[model samples]
Target chain A: MEEDPVELVVPEPIPEPTPSAPPEEVEKEEQPAQPTPPAEPTTAAPPQHPFLDRKDFYIPPASRLPEGSELALAKAFLMTQSEKSNLNLYDHLTEVIVRILETRPGNVVDAFETLSADIKRSHFVVDRPNAPGAFQKASEVAPANEIGAAQVKLFEKSGLEEPGDPEAFGEIPDIMDLSNLWEWAGVSLGKEETFMLFLSLKSLVTSKPLQSVRLWGKILGAKANYLIIEGELKEGAVDEDAPQVEEEVQENAEEKKEAEEDEDVPKRKEKPVIPLPREERVGVNKYVYYVCNYAGGPWTRLPDVIPEKLQASRRIRKFFTGDLNHKIVSYPPFNDTEAQYLRCQIARISAATVVSPSGYYTFDQEDENEDEENPQPQNIIINPEFESLSPEQLIDPANWVHHVPYILPQGRVTWENPLGQKGEEEANEDEDEEEGSDAGEGEEERENVEPETGPGILSPLSSDEGP
Target chain B: MSFINLDDLPYLTLVGFTLNTEEKAAIQSSLQVKKEQEKLEEIWLWGKILGVQRDYFIAQATKDNLFSRKFYYSIDLVNWLQLPDVPSSDMDRISQVHGRFTGDPAFEYSLGEEPEEGAEEKTINEEKRLSGTVALINYETEIVPRGAYYRDTLHQLQKNVNFSGIPKGELSQLTHYLHFREGFDINKRTLQERADAFDESIDIFETIANDEPKGVWSCQTERTGSVAILRSLLWPGYVFFHTANPPKWGSMYYGTGQRNLNIGFML
Candidate 1:
């Protein structure tokens, strides 16, 4: 009986030109009386029509058709005209269907109307009124380009000017060149660190109106090391009375008053302030310091150094903990934190050891032209007539004179701090008098006299003097 | 102390211990005077060992031979006090005491047990331990490039004046470095290992490459690959740097003078 049904079903031919006919129509016509098992062989046979050769347009046997195949074929047939016209019918239909399902409107036609109105109101699909086939507005086509331009403007507005383009800023000095100079002196922060510092310092110069910058040195700390960069501020950029310095000075003065009260010492009258010999731009405070936790971290400017802090720093030896706010608890307590201590140490190091070859700097002869009674403090200027010293003389310590002043024990180059108290000044004078009375100590007398005579040209005799 | 000048002093700043210009000048001048007065063969600043009160500035000198080198230390740069010679037995006793230096040369550490109890408690001075510790570290981790010194006709080890330096490329390799101590035992190596490389006269010390508990030495090139900096993992803050072209070298210890005893576990 099954054989008869299979033979009957196989012999019949249905001529169909369209591939989009529904499966139920084919099922009802082809297998009217046959059971499913007997109809399988006839269904497996190839379709007689020529259009079935196109795989995507081919219709499966009615019984074997997958779920949703009829709806898929209908959608495909509807997209055929738009495909040749460069339209994205598939994406549009899928988006509309997804929205309809999401909104689950009481009426399906209403959802499409509302979605179209919402998209128009939001300007997601910009419409050109005069164009044919609903063309989009020009502004909606190139949004990426606008975003990129806005980002460029943001960077420019932030003042983070890109470095290494010489055209913009005429030939700024490369800080990496300093690595070669320091290496010649047997000092370096290694190649990797120097390059990183160079990049970071270049960024720093752009943010601040700096005339020049250099890697001062690295200060190793217990937790993390600090990379120090020294820079010269532009002419009008320097803040003479920085707020941090003012706060530190006030705190120091209060501490001093408390200490004096504890000692039961009589308060003395304030003396006439002596004007500083030279501007802070020339001597110990010439360079502004910035430190970062690492090569590329945010740089923090250290507070200006005060004389009392500088003196106190020399009395104690401690390692930095890489924290600017770390309190230094020693016998003679540091008034400020590690930042001030670091500044004080830098001043001391620069004052004592920062040397240049002998003729690189010369005493300002113009200062000598002033009246001797009220002589201006001498300034060291770059020598126009500088002649390089021989290697022999350059190697000798005697030839390397300090350009900066010797920071006296009282912290200033001179004892006449106009801002200082008369009691402290008198105490310092008494100490000097006691040292002067000791005739056997010729070395102490020379040290006391060296600062008063201006910058000491290092002599062979001076190396013999020990503290 | 010509080996350590103001130029070379900045290298110590890398490892974070620096003497101010005054202290450095004083040390340089005073050491030169001491060298002349004592007629020493050679002298160089060993390093600074930190103490609770004050740091110890150590200077090492050789008298007649490298093996006869002595160490002198100072709290104040003006005075150089020779560390007392330590006997072999005291070296073991010194190992039992571990702590930061008191900055007092006279401070004594009691070892083993309380004196009031029945058990005997040995006492050791900080000065002796300082000397022993320096000697021990030197014997273990102090290294020089292989050809830096050679055996003379009299079998005396002498520095090679003609030795330019270890090449820059080979500097970071551990095999190029040898311990600057005496007593190399060739028998410890396999026959294949010593087949072509054994020489009793010149090869008088072991190579750092064969050191046990691997990864104890970290060698790196710095200063745009012109200088080599080698740090000891076994001794945390001991650093050695050498320049190939100009042929300059120095080592400084800026740590707490304590051995990294957990090195085995660390590896």
Candidate 2:
């Protein structure tokens, strides 16, 4: 028996995506488990300056290139590189991004070609907020701008923008350090066909505390033209109870009660959105997550807003969708509405997970008593997924990977920082002092410094700090 | 060469526990029992009190007098307990001591129902395990929370609570802090005697139990979201406490302009 040369995932197309096709749930009772820029030409605060960005750094093209590039799709490359771990360089990063954007086309297609044309031309001449935006503003319909007029319009129409501020990025455990946020990007692999991507500055730069890192992440996502920003926020140190989303939703919904957010995001044709079943497969908490090939159908445009609507992509999507409005989603078993879209997206996430070596299986079992024999429904179908965002896979304690995206020649780049970070920068000065002490640096030190000593602390602040 | 210490503790399902220095001291102290000279007999007792019966500690005192001591805190128990495969009694005694060390005076304990006063912390800890077969100590002494306690003991208990450790008010200040512990001699009680409380629980020397605070234990509230960050620069070891401030990273899930939300107690 020979393997099929053309198939990315071998065997029959695991049809587990179709939930109604007879629920063949393969439940993995497995345990569970920044960017930005802007210059304001030096206004806001010291931390807000573009001078904080490093000038020498440049993101290298990914070592592994996606297929189909150079043929159907143009070669994807990072537009600019300025963010660095040094906090002093943030201000410079904004200017660098804007400077890179001024010359390069905003359009995703021409973006690769336009960089050299305006390499010397400076179109991004310092614009303050509302100071007649320089590039095309990604409005309901993208308005044309300086960098590759049609290209800017194209990328803007896709609705992708730099990642947003602290208010936007959430769920980062307080024990995590956002400064080295990009180190976690090693797991995500992007698609050349789909315009979807998971964009972040975590892999490209470093910073302290999770908040500022998150803020920069939002901007980079928006600028890099990411379809979905699936990163998490800082874990609660106080508010140790569930923070109420409905309160904010109700208040926000007043403006768009029941808005139609369910226009385009895709749904798992067969499975329903539900929580992941309990399975203790691995005890090692994972920081590596995957964004799959499912491009939730086109943005689910909505008529009004509800609190839950903002949570996910739904048949009746209500929250201000970063990707939906941008038209980044193109495939789906769509929910009748965006409201269904959110639930549908969640369903798709629960219905299956990315099986390593490229298998996609339903994350939760629809059938309580699944039969292993007989034409048992294939719980996981190894599909040739391109670029998909499954938060359900991410939130799993066992599977969640606090990932940061690297922007370069290829699309999504994932790299893990071997140092491992939680919060606050230790300056890593220990390297200078202890370089010679590593001779016997084996079981003894690890035994002395096992990360689990604190027993799975939910936040770095919860560690036994001195009284 | 692989650097995992596989020989130390067998990895069962999850790692069990290894007692640190403080934990060892607690076990030693709680396991200490005093001999009661009823009238004039100077009978010596050994083995920490396993429990309290009325006014007497249902203790595991040595039947013979050889182990008796005027007060031998031990240079050997530390070395002895550290030996591979320490006895189960030592482990039990240590756990009992840990319970006492971290006990909060404001915490009210009710093993089934409240005991009739003068209960000892060690006895209280043993009864927490629902097996009747658990209390090996039968009584040579009793430690009761009386209606008349001095200011000393109350100060110690108050110092070890979740809130007190949080750098705030005294837990002993609460009137409801007095609980029926291990001692109060029930047989000595005449009819119409409640015998289980102190008029001023604020007075020190009263023993308190340690358990999850009433409302925040498991099975309470919706499955609240939590993000555990491991910051080595800060404190190490297990630190479980509640904070009003939620983590900022959670907001990344919502994407752009969404407010970051947090929950209570990040353990």
Candidate 3:
């Protein structure tokens, strides 16, 4: 099945409710039944939160929500009370979660738990930090003063070292060389920290093979700040307790094959691996690994790894972690520039289209309109072709590809072609003719609604049509 | 394909016109022309005013083999001359060029002053061009892979070029247009912004080079690796320019010819 798509679109404008009839008319309706006595007015209910009041707070119809949490499925059954109300409670809940994550000042778990049942049903669960199991029951109890603290404690208690910190787990292996790697990268570490680096290498072995070990060793020796660590090699000398030399030969053969195929997936740039090794193991020292506080070297050393020197210094650890997005630092602190820069960088990397600088000769597909009086060619960029898909279908990761030839039409042919300027005159004439015809018909304002001819009076078409 | 090799420095002295309403509008419209064959209309017109005539156009300025077109009001693509040891602003240099020509009576006469109440129409004298003429100056242009000049600073050219004699009103017109289009000081913009500005200018040029209309035709010479064209946008008459790859012109043809005039292929 294709990935579910996500898209951001401007919400359609909601029309305001029309004013009710005058108070006198309402009074007349009340007194219509033969001398009925007036009852005392009751106090109105307090307003609900906007998020809870939204249509999606109610369970959606089966048609609108094909897949959702158990809570959403339960709510959909209750929504049968009204025929007009059909909503997708899960998507609405997800959007609410995302909004809370962005704007609210509370922990993600606390925020979700504090919302009304309508906003977040008890059965709905989110894949948040510290919760690894699929669809774990959501917490109903709101933790006080422990915003995001429990998640950290859960990891610590589980005997898992924090990401990028292998020494905390005490899995340092024997016969591993790390001080040499740190020295090459110009990183000064204490004796204990050097031992930690050795363990970190062993930790990396879970995700990487002996070939990865060889490549990383070369990278460390070269003083490169960043290196991609593929997950631990599954089949290795360690499984059979074979000699380390034989394992090296086997890994080299595998790596050569992988390196050749690397070109096929060019979009997967900087394949850094965050080794989530379950446990540290020692096996004839078949591979070596390196770690340090930071990739503290001149960007020149890791030119291929971190080519964009503009963002090199800030992106060191983030680069190494790869898909394991475990984080240690809070973002958008007093100085939020780094956070904003990272956002733009991510957007650039994620975009499927590439717009190269102009004036360089590339394929000139702009000549399609060369026959016109004026040829206004636009800068080349990919035009997305998501045929007939709703906004939900547009956000799929699969939809974004590097090569899709869907360029928009080029610019106008003539700047001041007197011929094209007559559009306004013709529109005005049509309006005038319509008015004249209406007058001839002598029709009453039965509908009392404005005709939807042309764009509204305030539109550019009206201005241009005017003298 | 035969090619003409001309000196590049002199035409800087000769051609002049502004991105005025009529001219800018013409070029803008031509750039946006839908027909591939007509895209070069504005460029051909500009080139024709620069005295590069082609046989394809039957312009009012061209009557016979004998040359008839004149450069009364035209825009030139020329740089301001920087003298050694003299530190002057680009504005002052541009002012000097304008100052030299605005004083000429013939230029004043060509601004609709000479043809008094339809007495008779007369051609412009080549030496006495007007002050209002625009001189597009772009220095330090890098030849991109496609042979297009990218990131050349026109605002700098506007500031440092001598425009001494041009009236304040005319000068403001040029400055206003440049500011409106490329921003007041384009150099201060980010790399992406500068790239965008340069790309826009190239879009205009690309339209002119590849597209040919009734009176406009441009083609790169196969023999000499230069682009040559004839056009009549600048004046009532046709002007032609044969620009070599490095843009040193060898010969120029100013005058008129019948419709469907075929100047031999440059290539």
Candidate whose lDDT is highest: 1
DockQ: which candidate is best? 1
Error of model 3, residue A364, in angstroms: 69
**Which stretches of model 1 miss by more than 4 angstroms?**
A1-175, A238-243, A251-265, A268-282, A367-377, A417-464, B1-237, B240-267
Q: Please report the candidate that would top TM-score against the real structure.
A: 1
In Å, residue A118's CA in model 1 sits off its true spot by 48
C-alpha lDDT (0 to 100) for residue B27 of candidate 3 = 37
lDDT for B43 (candidate 1): 75
* Separate clash counts for every candidate: 2, 195, 79
Give TM per candidate: 0.43, 0.16, 0.16
lDDT of 2 by residue, B53-132 (tens): 21111122233231221221222232111112224654444333322212121233333434458964334332332111
- Model 2: CA > 4 A from native: A1-199, A203-226, A237-245, A248-347, A356-467, B1-267
Q: Looking at model 3, give its docking quality level.
A: incorrect
Residue B216 alpha-carbon offset, candidate 2, angstroms: 54
After superposition, which runs of candidate 3 have C-alpha atoms over 4 Å from their true positions? A1-467, B1-267
Please state the Cα-based DockQ of model 2 relative to the true two-chain complex. Answer: 0.01
Checking candidate 1 for backbone clashes, the offending pairs are A273-A418, A274-A418
